[model samples]
Target chain A: MNNKNSGGSEAEDLAKAEMVRLLSIVGRDRSADAFEAIFRFYAPRIRSFMAAKTKDRQAAEELMQETMTAVWNKAGQFDPARGNVSAWIYTIARNVRIDAYRRKRPEFDMNDPAFVADDVAPADQEFQQIQEAQLLRGAMATLPEEQLDVLRRAFFDEASHSTIARDLGVPLGTVKSRIRLAFEKLRSSLEGRL
Target chain B: MNVKHHLSDEFLIEYAAGSLSEGWSLAVASHLALCPECRQRLHAMEGAAGALLDKADESANEDEAWARFKARAADIKVEEVKLEAPKATKQTVVLPEPLRSYVGGDLADLKWRALGRGAYQILIETKDKNTQVRLLRIPAGKPVPEHTHEGRELTLVLAGSFHDGEELFARGDIEEADGDLLHTPKATEGEDCICLAVTEAPLKFSSWIVRLVQPILKI
Candidate 1:
C-alpha cells in the first residue's frame, strides 16, 4: 500500500511536469512537436468524454476535433498558475459541446447579455488553487464508495439529484445528503489552508 | 460588497456541467461576478471534473482522430490577439461586470417602460425562447401584486432591499422561487428596490385586474 501510494504521487508529479512543458512550448513557440504530443495524449480521452455526452461516434469525433483546434488556437491563454492543464482543457471541451448544441438552435446567440467572460484569479491566488486541488483530491480519495459513486454520476453524467437517487434505488433526500456530506468534508479538509 | 446569499451548489454544478439553460446560466454568471467565494467554489468543481476526465476510459479511434485533427490544424490560422482589460465606466449606479457589457451605460440610459402602479421595468431581449429576463425597479414602499410562479423564477437584488413577507433581500441576495412558492414582495421604505428577475415561464398574478393586464405587461 505504501509503495502504491508513493507511485501514484510520482505519476501525478510527472503528469504535471509534462503538462507544464507542453503549455510552455505551445504558448511560447507554437512548436508542432509539443502540439503533437498534446494531441496524442488528450485526443482519445477527449473523444471518450464527448462520446459519453453525445452517444454518437461521428458527432463525438467532430466535437473532439473542434475542441483540439480550440486548444491549438487558444494555447497562449493557458495559464498554469490559474488552473491545472487538465481542468483548463476540460473547460474547453465542455464549452465546445455546449456551443455545438447552441448551433443547432440558431436562435440562441452566444453573445447574449447574461453571458460574461470567465474570471481568472490573480497570480497570487494560484498557489491556493493548486494546494486546494491537491487537498480536494486527497479528500475525494477518503470518501465512501457509495458517496463517490453518486458524485461521479453527478459530475460525469450530469445526472440530477433525483435521477441519481432513482438509479441508486435510494430516497431523494439520501442522495442530496450524501452529496452534501461529501462537499462538507472537502470544504473542511481545505478550510484553514484556503 | 458583503454578499450574504450565494448561488446554490446544484446551480453551480449545472453551470460547470454546461447543463443549465441560457437564461439561468446568465443569472448565475451575474451572481458569480459579484461573489468571489462562489467563483472559488466553481473553480473547485471544475477541478473535480478535470480529475474525473483524467480517469475516464479512452476511445478506440485515437490514431484516426489525431490524423484528421492534424490535417485540419495545418489549415487553421490561430490568432495571437491579446485580451484587453475591462475599462471602468463612470456611471451613477455601478453595474456589475456581467450586466455592464449588456447595458453599455448606467441606470439612466435604460429605456424603462412604466409597469402600472409606479413599478418600472425594462425587458431585456435574450435569444432563449423558454426564458424571459427583465429589470424591475419598484418604488419605495410599493408592493408587487401577490403571485405564484408557473415555473422557476430567480430574482437577484441588484440595488436596495425588499421584503417578501418572510425574508429581507438586500443587494446581491438571490431568491429562487418555483411553482410552489407564492408571495407578495414590497420594496422597503428607505430605498427603491431594483431587481434582475429571470423566469422560465410567465408569472401567475393573484389579482384578477393584474391578470387582465398581464398580457399587456408581458412579464
Candidate 2:
C-alpha cells in the first residue's frame, strides 16, 4: 500500500506538469504537439471515467474523444488562475457526458434551463479555489470508509439515495444521513480555506 | 443579494457528480446563476470530482482513444463568439443569465395567462413529458392554496419573497418539496413574487375548486 501510494503521487505530479505545459501551449500557440500530449495523458483516464458512467465501451470512447475536442476548442477560456487544468478538464468531461446522456434520453431538454454562464473571479478568489481543492483532497483521504463508500457510490454509480440504501442493505434514512454527514465533514474541514 | 435558502448539500453533490436528472439540474443551475455561494460550492465539488477521476483506474484502450482523439480534433470547430446584447437598465428586466437565454427576452416579454385570483403563469415547454417547468407571478399578499406534490417540486425564487409554513424564501433561494410535505405558500406584502418552478408531476391542490380546474390549468 505504501509503495502504491507513492507511485500514484509520483504519477499525479507528472500529470500536473504535463497539464500545465498543455494549457500554456494551447492557450498561446495552439500547438498540436502539446494538444496531442494532453490527449495521450488524459484520454485513458477520461475513457475509464465515462465507461463507468455509460457502461458502454463504444459510447465511452466517443464521449472521450468529444471531451478532448472541447478541450482544444475551449482552451482559450481556461484560466490557470481560476482552477488547475485537471478541474477544468473534468468539468468539460462532465458536460460532455451530460450532453451525451441528454441526446440518448428523449425526455431531457437542454433549452428551457440553459447552462450557467461562467463567471470570472478575481485572482485571489482563484487562489482560494486552488487552496480549497487541496484542502478537500486531504479531507477526503481522512474520511471513514463507510462514509467514503456512500459518497463513492453516490458520485460514481450515480445511484439515488434509495438505490444506494437498497444496494447496501440499509434504510433510506441511513443512506441520506451518511451522505449528509460526509458532506458536512468535508465542508467543516475546508471551512476557513474556501 | 444574500441568499438564505440555498440548495441542500445532497442536491448540490448530485448535481456536481452529474447524477441529477435534467429537470432538477435545470433548477439547480438556474439557482446557481443567481447565487454565488452555491457556485463556489459547486466548484469545490467539481474539484473533488477531479481528484476522484485522477485516482480512477486506467482504461485498456489508451492508444486507440488517443488515435481517435487526434483524428477528430482537426474537424472540431471553434464555438462562434456570442454577440453581447445592449444591456437593459430597467428594473423590470431582471431575469438572470440562464433564464434570459431561455425566455429570449426580459420578464416583460412573457405572455402571462391569468390563473385565477391574482396569480399569472407561463408554462415553459420542454422535451421532458415527465416534468413540467413554468414561471409563476403571484400578487403581493396573495396566498396560494395549500398543496402537496404528487412527485417532486423544486421552486427557485427569482423576485420578491414567498413564505410557506416552514420558512421565507427570498430571491435566489430554492425550495424543494416532495410528496410527503404539504404547505400553502404566500407572496409577502410589499412586492409581487416571481418564481421558476419545476415539478415532476401535477401538484395536488387541497382546495376542491382548484383541484377541479387542475386539468384545465395543466399545472
Candidate 3:
C-alpha cells in the first residue's frame, strides 16, 4: 500500500485529468487587469530573481518589464488548468534570466550538460535544516485536519497504504485518496516559494 | 509514461524552485495542487527559500518596486480582464512522452549557472526550498563519486550511457535504486551523459574522500 507507484494508479489518473480542468481557467480571460493581476503578483519577485544575477537593480527592473511584456504577448500560451499562475510566470522568468545570462556570458554554453552539472552544488547547503522545517509547519496550517493526518503518516512513518490502512482501520484506497487530496491542496497553496 | 506515478522528491524540488520548463511546470503545479504529501515537502522547501530571501546580502529589486507595480495595474482595464475562457469538455492531463506519467512534468524554473568548461547546473528549487537544484555536467571521461542512494531513487538516461555500479543505462532506461545500491557512473567515452534523477534524500558517499569533498561541492 505504501508503494508510491502501487495500486493507486486510478488516483494518479484523476490527478492528471484534473489539470485540464485548471488550465481552462487561465485561458478564459486575457484582459489588461488580468494581466495586471499576474504582473503584480510576479513582477517584484521576478525583479528580485534577475537582480540576484545582474547585481544591477535598474537592469533587473528593466528585465522584469520585458519579461512581463513577453508574458502579456504570450498569455495565450498559458493553461491555468494545467498549472497555477505562479508556476507559469516563474517559468517565463527563468527562461528570460537564462537567456539574459547567456547573452551576458556568451562563452557559457547552454547545451553542455557536463558544464551544468559541474556548476550545480548540493541543494540544502545554503539554508539550515531548521528553517526548512519551520516553513513546512506554516504550509501545514493550510491543510485540512484529515489531509494533514494522512500526510504526517506518509512523511513520518514512511508508511505504505496497507500499513497505514491496517493501523488506521481504513481501506487502502481511502488512504491513497486522502493523501492525494492533501498533497494537491498543499501544492496549490505553496506555488513559487516551495 | 505512468502519469499516475507521484513526482520524485528531486523533481519536485526542481519544480518548486521554478527550474523546470514552462510546459512542464504547468503540469507539475497542477499535479502538486492535487497531491498533499508533495505539497508539504514543497512547503518546507519554500520555508527554506524564505530563509534565503531574508538573507541581508541576497540581491532584490528596490523597496518601491511595488509602486511601479501599482502604476502598471492602474493602467489595466478591469472589465476586459474579467472575461473567461471556455473550459475543455473532458478532464485530461496529457503530457509529452516519457514524462507524461511522471508526477512533475518538465523542470520549468531552474536558473542555470555555468561551470568551467562545458558544465552547467540549473539552480532548481531546493529540497527544503531553502537549498537549490544544482544540475551538474561532466565530460565523457568524468567519474562522479561512488555513492549509495539515501532512499528510493529514479534515474532516467536523457542522453549518453553511464555505468551505475556495475550496470549501464542508456537513454530512456529508468533506474530505480534503493539504499543498498552503490553507484559510480562514468559517462561513456565520446559523448557526455545527461541523466535526470529524482532523489528524496542526499547521496550517501561510500568513500571518505567523497564525504570530505561534499561540503565544497555544495551548490
Candidate 4:
C-alpha cells in the first residue's frame, strides 16, 4: 500500500509503529525473523529508489544488501520516540548509496572540538523530528503538481539543477523558483507545528 | 544574528538527498556546521525526501535475495553506542568534523602555501575529479585574484570577511557563484579571511601577475 497521496491515516500510523517495534527487536535481540521482515519490505523499496538515481542494477543490489546489513548492525541506534522508521531507514539508504556510488560525502561530526551545538534543547529537537516527518508527508500531498514533480526529481535524480532545467526544457530561473516555492509552501504548511 | 548568507533550497535538497558529489558535499556540510538556521531547513528537506520514498515503485523481489543477505547476517557488527564515532580526534577544536578529518587536525594544523600578494592556499584532496576543494587564506585588506569562473565556485567563509562587489560575506556565509558571474573578492581589514572554496573547472585569473603564477601554483 504505497498510498503516498493520503495524509497520515490510522493504518499508516499503525504500520509505522509496528515497523518501529520490528526495528527495535532487531536492535535488541538480533532477531532474524524481525530483520527478514524489514529486509523484505525495505529491500525492494531501496532497489527502486536506487534505480531512479542510477541504472546499475548490480550496484543497487550491492548497496541494498549493505543497507540491510547496516540496519541489522545499527538498529539499536533507531529511536521510535525521536522519529519514524521510514525517515531513519531512508537516511541510512541515502548514506550507503552516496558512499558506494559517489565516494565519501563528509558530514559535520557533532563530536568535533569546534562544532557548534544547536541552541534548541535535545528534548525539543526530538519532539520536532517525531512530529515533522509525519506533518511533512501530509503537507507533501497538498503541494502543487509542478512543484511536487520537480521536488521529487530533485530528491531522486542525481542530476544537477542546470541539467534538470535542460531536461525539463524550462528556464533555469523557473526551476529554481519552483523549488523555492515548493519549499516555501511546505514550510508554511508546517509553520506552527515544526 | 544568523549567518547573512545561506545555501539556496536547491543545494539543501540535493545535499539532503545524498545526491551531491564529494566536493559539493564538503562545502555544504562545512556550512551546516557553522549555520544552525540552515540545519533546521535541511532537516525539513530531508523529511520531505523521506516522504517521497513512499511513492517509489516496488519491483519484483526474490527469496534468493534474502537468502544471500542471510548468508552474511552473522557478521553484523552492531554499533556499541548508537551513531557516535570514536572520540579519538584530539585537536578538532577549531574545524568541524569530516573537514577536521580531511585537514588532519584543527586550524593551527594547516600548512599554507604562499600564493603571492599576501594570499595563501592549501588544496585538499577529494575523490571527485570534476571538482577541486581547497582552503584559501586572504590577508586582511588585500584583494584576491579577480576570477571568471569556467564552472561553479562555492565559497564558505570560515573566518574573517570578504567583499565580493557590494556583498560582504563574513564567517559562516556561503556563496555559490557560477555562470557568467565574475568576482573580485577583497578581504576586509582587521582579520585574515580563511575559507573553504570548491571550484569546478579551472578559473581564469585576470591579474597578469597572478595569472602568471597561477600555472605554477595551480590555484
Candidate 5:
C-alpha cells in the first residue's frame, strides 16, 4: 500500500530478471562471462551464508566453493521461464552447505541417496525451491502487515518470543501466538500450491 | 512412500540447518519425491538457510580452498545427471501395505535387507554418493540398542507405534532427535511398526563388531 513496499517488490523483480538473464547465458554457453560475473557477485556473499550455521571459517569456505562449483556445473539447467536465479542458486548453496556439514561429522546415516549421487546437481533435482520461494513471497504479500512482519522476525531473525514482544511493545504471549498463527496460516495458504 | 508422513516445517528447518541424521534425511528425501508440499517447504528453508549462511564471519578462507575445488571440478565434466538412478526409480518402494494401499500411484521400488535381529534396511533410490537416502524399518516389539543419536534424527511414524522414554509415537507422529539424547524405542503391541527414519550417520552400535561390519555393510 505504501511507496516503499512497492519499490521493494519492484527491486526484487528486477534482481530476479537480471538473474534469469545471466543464468540463461550460463546455461547455454559455459564460456560466457555471466558465469564469472555470477561467481564474483555471489562467492563473497556465500561465505557469510555458510558462517551463519557454523562458526568455522575453513568449513564455510569449503561449502562456499562447493556451492559455486554447482552453479558452474548446473548453469545449463536454469530455466528463466519458471523462477528467479537467486532462489535457484540459494537452494544450491543451501544443499551444498548441508552436505558439507554432514561430511564433517561422522554421526548416523541421514544421507538422501537422491541428493548424494555425484552427477545429480541441484538444478537436476526438482525446481520446486524457486517455485516455492516465489509462491511464498507472493502469498506473503497477501497477509496482514503485522502478521507478516511477526513471521519474518520469528523465523528469519530467529528472534525469541520475549525479544519480539519487547521490541514490538506487545505481550510475550501475544507475540508467540501471533507467530504460531502466522505460520499456521502460511502453511494452509501454501499447502496446496506446494 | 507414506504420503501421510509428510515432512513438517520443523523438520524442514532442521534439514536446511543440516541438523538431521543420515537415515532420517534419506527418508525425508523419499517423502519429498512423493509430497511437493514438503519439497516446497525445504526450498523456502533453503532461502532462510542462505540468509543464515550469509551471516558467517568474513575474515577467513581455507588456504587451498579454491585450488582444491578447481582441481575437483576439472577432474569431472559435470552435467545433467537425472535426479533418480535407474535402480532407484526401478525399485518398487515397498511401503507398509496400508501405506501402499493409500498411495494408489506408482512408487519407487527398493531392495530391502535384514540388518540383524529386529532391524531391516531398504535401499531407497538416490542420485549420488553425496546424496545418500535409505529406509531403515524396525519391526514391531523389537527394541534398538540404547544409543545416542549420531547426528540429527527425523522419525516420522508411518504406522503402528513406538516408544522412546515417556513418549509414544503413532501414525504421522514425527520425532527429531540428535546427539543430545540417548534412548531406545520398541514397537508397540499388535502393529508391525512402520516408520520413516532419516539420518546423516549410521547408528553407532555399542558392539565393536557391528562397527566393523558397518563399513562393509555400507549403511
Candidate 6:
C-alpha cells in the first residue's frame, strides 16, 4: 500500500461528506431534492455493478431499481456512525443481487447470547469516518491489476471460487491466493485506521 | 474469545460479497461473533468493498433510469413506512444469533443421535441442496470417525477444542478440510466438543457401518 495512488484528496472527501449529508436529508425530511441528487449519483454506479454480474441489461436495470427502492425506503437504516454511503449502498446492492440469483446470506444476531459485542466504541470513530473509507478505497485502487480483477470478480460478480478458477483458466489455489493477497493488502492498509 | 485457528480470508471475502450460501455463511458469521480480530478484518473488507462500489463504471440511459425509479417510488406511501432502530442492547446468552433460531433455542437443548464410539450428530436442514450442515458432539478424548471429504468441509468449534493432525482448534476456530485431505479429529480430554460442520459433499466415510447408514445419517 506504499504507493496508494494517494490521489484521494480533500475534494473527494468533501464530495463524500456531501453525499452523506444528502442521504441524511433524504432519510429525515424525505426531501425530494436530496433524494434526486442521491438517485442520480448512486444509481448509475449500482447499475454498472449489477450489469457486470447479471450480464443481462434488463435484469441489471431491474435489480438496480429494486436497490434504489430499498435505499429510498430504508434510508433511515443507514447509520453513518457504522459506515458511509458507499458501504451502505453497496450492501443493499449485494443483498438485492444475491436474493435475485443466489440463496440468502446467513447473518449472526448481535443480540444472540453466544455473541461477543464491540462494547467499546472505536475512539474518534465518527470523526475519522470519512477518512476510514478513503483509506480503504485508496488501498484498493493501488492493488495490482491482476489482484484487483479477481477481487471485483469475487465481490461484484459473486462468482464461486471454483467457477472463477475455471473461467480464469487457473488452478483453484491460484484464485484463493489472489483473493488472500488482495485482502491482506487491504487489511494492513486499514490497520490502525479501522 | 481466544481463537487459535481462524477461517481464511477467502471465506470472509465470500461472506462480505454475499457469495457464500446459508450454511457456510452461518459458520463464518458465528466465528465473527466471538473473534473481534476477525470482525475488524470483516469490517475492513466491507469498507474496501464500498470503495469498489464507489468507483464502479457508470451505467447508461440516465433520464430513463431516474424516470423509472421515480415511477416506482410513487407507488409507496412514505407515511406508512416504518423506521425501526435495530435492537443493540447486549444480553448474556449462550447461543449466538441466527444459529439459535436454527437450533430452536439454547445450545443445551439439541438432541443428538449416536454415531458410535461416543460421537453424536444432529443434522441441520438447509434449503441449499449443494451443502449439508450438521452439529457434532464428541465426548472428551473420543475421536470422530476417520473420513475424507469429497468436497470442501468447514468445521467451526462451538464449544471446547479438538486435535486434528498437529493443529488444535478451539472455540471460534474453523477447520477447513478439502477433498485432498484425510484425517481424524479427536476431542481433547476436558469437555465434550461441540461443533457446526458444513460440507459441500457427503463425507467419504472409511468405515462400513457408517457407510451402511450413510443415507439415514445424511452426511
> Compared to the true structure, candidate 1 yields what TM-score?
0.87
* Prediction 5 TM-score vs. true: 0.53
Candidate 6 lDDT over B143-168, as tens digits, reads 88888888788998888789998999
lDDT of 1 by residue, B48-114 (tens): 6776777665746466777787788889998876775544433344456466555555576778899
Which residue pairs collide in model 4, if any?
Answer: none
Candidate 4: count of backbone clashes, pairs at least 3 residues apart or interchain: 0
* DockQ, structure candidate 3: 0.05
lDDT of 4 by residue, A1-194 (tens): 32343367757666666888899898789899998888887888888777777688887888888888887888887876766677777788888877776477778877765566689888887777666666777788788888878877777776677888999999999989988998897787667573
Q: A1-194 in candidate 2: lDDT tens per residue?
A: 11222222444545675687678788677788888777776788888878877899788888888888888888877776654677788878878887877731112122233223335557667666555555666666777789878876776667888889999999989988887887776677667453
What are the per-residue Cα lDDT tens digits for candidate 6 across A1-194? 22344446657667787888988888888887898888888888898889888788899889988999989888866777664788888888999988887576878765555677665566666655556677777777778888888878887888888888999999989998888888888777666454
Docking level for model 3? incorrect
lDDT of 4 by residue, B86-143 (tens): 5765543656767778877668888999987788999999888899899999999998
RMSD after CA superposition, every candidate:
4.2, 4.7, 16.8, 3.5, 10.4, 2.9
At residue A16, give the lDDT of candidate 3.
28
- When 4 and 5 are scored with DockQ, the better candidate is 4
Task: Give the clashing residue pairs of candidate 2, or none.
Answer: none
Query: What DockQ would candidate 1 receive versus the native complex?
Result: 0.35
Rate residue B133 of model 4 by lDDT. Answer: 91
Using DockQ as the measure, which candidate wins?
6
Which regions of candidate 1 fall more than 4 Å away from where they truly are? A1-8, A103-123, A145-155, A160-172, A192-194, B59-61, B89-93, B100-104
lDDT of 3 by residue, B87-119 (tens): 332323222222322323443433445544455
The reply for model 3, stretches above 4 Å from the true place, is A1-30, A103-194, B1-171, B174-219
Pairwise DockQ winner, candidates 2 and 5: 2
DockQ, every prediction: 0.35, 0.36, 0.05, 0.55, 0.14, 0.62
Which candidate tops TM-score? Answer: 6
Is candidate 3 or 4 superior in DockQ?
4
